[model samples]
Target: MNVQMADAEITVHTAASIDRIAPEIHGHFAEHLGRCIYGGIWHADSADGDGFREDTVSLLEDLELPVLRWPGGCFADDYHWEDGVGPQDERPRRRNLFWAQGPEELPEESNSFGSDEFLELCERIGTEPYLAANVGSGSPQEAANWVEYCNYDGDTELADRRRENGREDPYGVKYWGLGNENWGCGGQMSPEQYAREYRRYATYVGTQANLMFDHDLELIACGFEGHEWNRRFLEEINEAPWGAEFPLDHLTLHHYYGRGTNVAEADEDKYDRMLAEALEMERHIERMAGAINAVATTRDIGVIIDEWGTWHPEATADNGLEQEGTVFDALSAAAVLNIFNDNSDVVTMTNIAQTVNVLQCLVETDEDDAWARPTYRVFDLYAPHKGNEAVRTSVDTPTRDVVDGDSNDELPLVNASASVGDDGTYVTVTNLDCRSAQTVDVSLEGTDLNEDDIRGEILFAEQEPDYAVTKHNADEFTADDLAVPADGSSIEVELPPSTVAAISVE
Candidate 1:
């Protein structure tokens, strides 16, 4: 097949080879700051007695979420674990000064949703807990206490205190984050300073057995861009005078897509640029992971993109810290997931920027009404990729420039990835073009399958730049809007431009 381009003709290859695909990636992450905890996931007005919103829980259950991160973005740095524990009445509350504009308030520290509550929520949702500890403005002892509070089972002081507080059994959380965004919201520390603090915290926090029975507790040292922080962290751990091989299981990296007044006002060109930023996250993960692996070979440390998603300038408009998720956001999310699948070897775990109302949240709420955002739909579409091994697939297409007017830059037009599971093979293809649709032949080389055996489901909207959050049709969309593939396998189908199509082959 020949695709005519503005400047030249490009040949398309139908039978792309499957040889160099990466492993499948893991998903998890949520912060207590913003509505993520209060209005988002933990609604005090829940019809269910658990204080968790039934609608939210039901939506999460539908996605089959694998893991969840909690309690902090920048808020983790200033979070006092004691503030959120014990009795709600006895707990003191303080005004959140991190994201909030006004002065710090008091009597705001209710333990209604502290360690126990969070773990319970995770259990209800059927996902693993990824806890972030305080490093900035917090002492090493504080960090140690939290670990002990969650994992320790012996009759020690902390354990006894936990028992006195409420439950006697340990939560047994496996993943622990040292800090969040140390370069910015996490206290603006230098690479050397953060590395030293990471070593100090890792040395003190005791390890916990993995409750899920997969692997041991992983202590993730917070890492930054470039090789500076990675090198410093490895050096500190390797050359420690104590000679302790603290199990640094993962290093964290964060990236956000879209930087504009609002996602709605973001031009198609700018949206394309945001797609490039999402793609760049994979490169960042690759470079950072390589640096960490090179310095420490004995310990198996993977990369965790704990915080990532599209961040619009207008995100804080509705409630000062809330961001709207649109159809464009959904498309971008699909692109990001593809990148993660492509680099799953080193990029093991990722948490979308938030679970609820921060940025690119899966679901959004406003007092009485709750709706699944476009990004959430993308997650629903790609949920099957979770825990599945990734399969390699290649494409030959005419590449066109994705131009952004604001930045005056261009990115590639075609983006695609594939994953194979126990049931069948799944391929996700995206046409970055905003207007035109391109037809290409796809060949499955390794598997002996007929084209008629494949099934395809395409997610697209008639309107321009439709997103999950905004594309609400009161009559059409419902909780069931995000189910498995309804349409059986067909040989030819139109992949709507600027949309995601999930193709399943049995």
Candidate 2:
């Protein structure tokens, strides 16, 4: 179907303003599942010397991730921050009941990675820390103590404990999560029940700011997508005895593309399905924004896609939730990022599921060596769009109807979004078809803009068929893949099947 494509035109109205794209929208999630915490991001007395793997930090730094959500997808609720602090040997090793994907007790959580470790990791990679508190299995006092320990500079017991841990200055964590999925694994509570829990936690976990020291903390409540999660959460939250001015700053939602929510089981039509699902992200943003606006007491409350990206395959036996990245995955990522750019107004921050070795991970490591997957490459290409003003792009292209199993979906073979900044204009295009190469004509508008005045790079398979577009395993990867080459002009570009191209005017 892609092979039959001829030409397409993308007109970017640079004069039109589409809001500033927050770098946080390209954020990552690091869960305690699998190697994400253990082998992938942390190790003792190694390369970085502070326990984190050297190559892991180096690769993550390359992603330019603006925010990193720490600790637990489902594991956050069961987490007791107290168990992770103080001495490493003294930290308790608790049974992780979430990674087994059920009520069955399985796997052990080494509380080696705590608040200090998480904050330190964020500092090394220059990403803001978004800590999710334990609201399910832990008490309000425990959550409150963590806030004080991380943000308070006062001579309190918690602050003193933090000082004794060898870090004198506060971590000053601003983005705080009240809880994770309360409707599901977090608690399996009714929406009303979770809202009640949120109030209790937010009451104690106030901004953690004091007169002597001030920190502007943005609190996010665990929200849901699909179902009535958002409506029920927002509706009941206001009913919350709040005990103070509503502390909720944002609502959280999670999405994964596929029927079973596992990527390894994705069929041949996975790419087409992902493209269709990615397109639906725009509608999801709009609907969520509408719901948020309707019930929000504050004008600043927005939606954060805190946990997203594809989670394919059953977890590996020893590793659990580990996934390999693919070229199709890259295109899917491009489509999703473009949607985030389009809805830059309200969809402020998004973290791609688990950042390492887990679902949709950017980097997979074997012992000391780390490999940057195709998904990682996608983020690198989009780094320019961060904090840039979104430029409206109209793409006129042919459509293809993909019959994915029992579902029928229609989507454009070509998708694009553009942004303008002090540096220049950035236009990223994604082609869903994998059989044919496509040529697209792009124009940059606005008084200060000129698209053709810059250079471009393409990731077409035809140009480098031997290059590894994705890696199924560590041994199967090829490192010398084609960099987005600077051979072409900005106005004209070629896209091969399942390709993502970046055009820059710098």
Candidate 3:
């Protein structure tokens, strides 16, 4: 299963589609699941004098994340907004039955990190706050109040209570998710039932322009699993004026990788199966988005893959909730990013499953130390591509039948996406073969850039023949960790199988 090098030429017509390209490809997500909130990003202990972590803040700022989703995966439905606000002393500590060990064993949640804290964190990081409301276990009044509490500035009962809590000014948060996975954890309801409930919530919430705050509200309707959900949601919304008038800005979808009882034991064959599943999910989204557009002819809606990442069944072990990111995780991430870039027109936003602890997190922390996982490295390498529109390019490589007994029999030898920034053009390539390196002849025919303007960097595991997810301590990486190529033209490069490489053309 090697990528055989050939001189087959593929042309990329950049000039023809340059005007169609968009610059806003960067987006992120944060959920209140596991340690993603309590210990992952909002650690009270890690806060400096300003009550914010310098390290976490610095990392988020570097990524320049455009938007972030919060306060739920499944936790949102069971979550009561009042539980995470007001006086910390008055807030009751409830048992987190989601991922915690036991009711009494769970840490005390003082309600200190409520809507205000999240908005403050988003403000500090210069990112938009995408809040998910509770619909499964909550009422429409609760949903409306949650919205008002964050966006209202008037002297209403909720607004007055918010002012009394300490903050008088409104956060003006815009993006509001109706609920998390309504088809599953959020609440296993039929599409018809969810749509009826969605209309009920939307009618009371009002439009984004009518909010008490300055910003506009963008309501997100949770579509069902696959295209059927998307079709059903649009049909129901189109039929009702309340649903159509509620400022439905985006439709949301969620997908994860791996499905075995143990992810660590998921061999290469299983990994390929996961990749195939992800590809199918991506295609399904595209089809579903098209179906929505067909019905909602007048409205402009986008797809938000708010929840996505590699999920191993063994994520929360007795040792801890965090799963160590490995080379396979990096490869999977690279593939996911490629899907996002390729489907930028429809998929507007995406966030890896859990930022720190649950799934493929960028930064994993312990009691005393923190380290960058392979997935984090992939993110760092691809960070520059955020905000840059993807350039349509052609890839030519031999496809092999490597699935063995798995579902997908064939996998491309090379997977890549190119983005042209203000100062340079960047191309990211991944070799999917788990056994051999790949030699790709990438031609920049559409642009007038010369060979001297191009440079390259690679991120392959130091260990040979094994794609185990490993963590790199702070000191393990340096400037040389990014393998930027020397000044050369038409040079032969070896990309380790199951590795990611980034090349820049200045």
Worst window of 10 by summed lDDT in candidate 3: 16-25
Considering lDDT, where higher is better, how would the candidates rank from best to worst? 2, 3, 1
- lDDT of candidates 1 onward, in order: 0.66, 0.75, 0.67
Off by over 4 Å in 2: 1-6, 44-49, 100-106, 210-212, 240-245, 259-268, 314-319, 404-406, 447-452, 460-490
TM-score: which is higher, 1 or 3? 3
TM-score, cand. 1: 0.86
| Residues 1-506, model 2: lDDT tens digits | 12323388788888887999999999999887777777788873122327878889998987768999988788899888888888887777787777742112247776777788889989989999999998888888988888888988878988899999988998888898988988888888888898888888887776455443576778888887764778877788767553554568888888877434344445546656666876777777787888887877565787899988765545454546765566666668888999899888887799997787777788887665778877787788788899999978999987778776898888888889999999877888887775576777776664333434565665535422213333334333322232332223226566767778877776
Error of 1 at 316 (Å): 3.1
For candidate 3, write residues 264-298 as lDDT tens digits: 66666666666665556567677767886788888
Query: Residue 83, candidate 2: how far off, in angstroms?
Result: 0.6
Among all candidates shown, the one with the greatest TM-score:
2
Which one is best on lDDT? 2
Model 3 sits at a Cα RMSD from the real structure of 3.8
* TM agreement with the true structure for every prediction: 0.86, 0.89, 0.88
Better of 1 and 2 by TM-score: 2
Clashing pairs in 2: 3-436, 263-311, 263-312, 264-312, 264-313, 315-321, 434-497
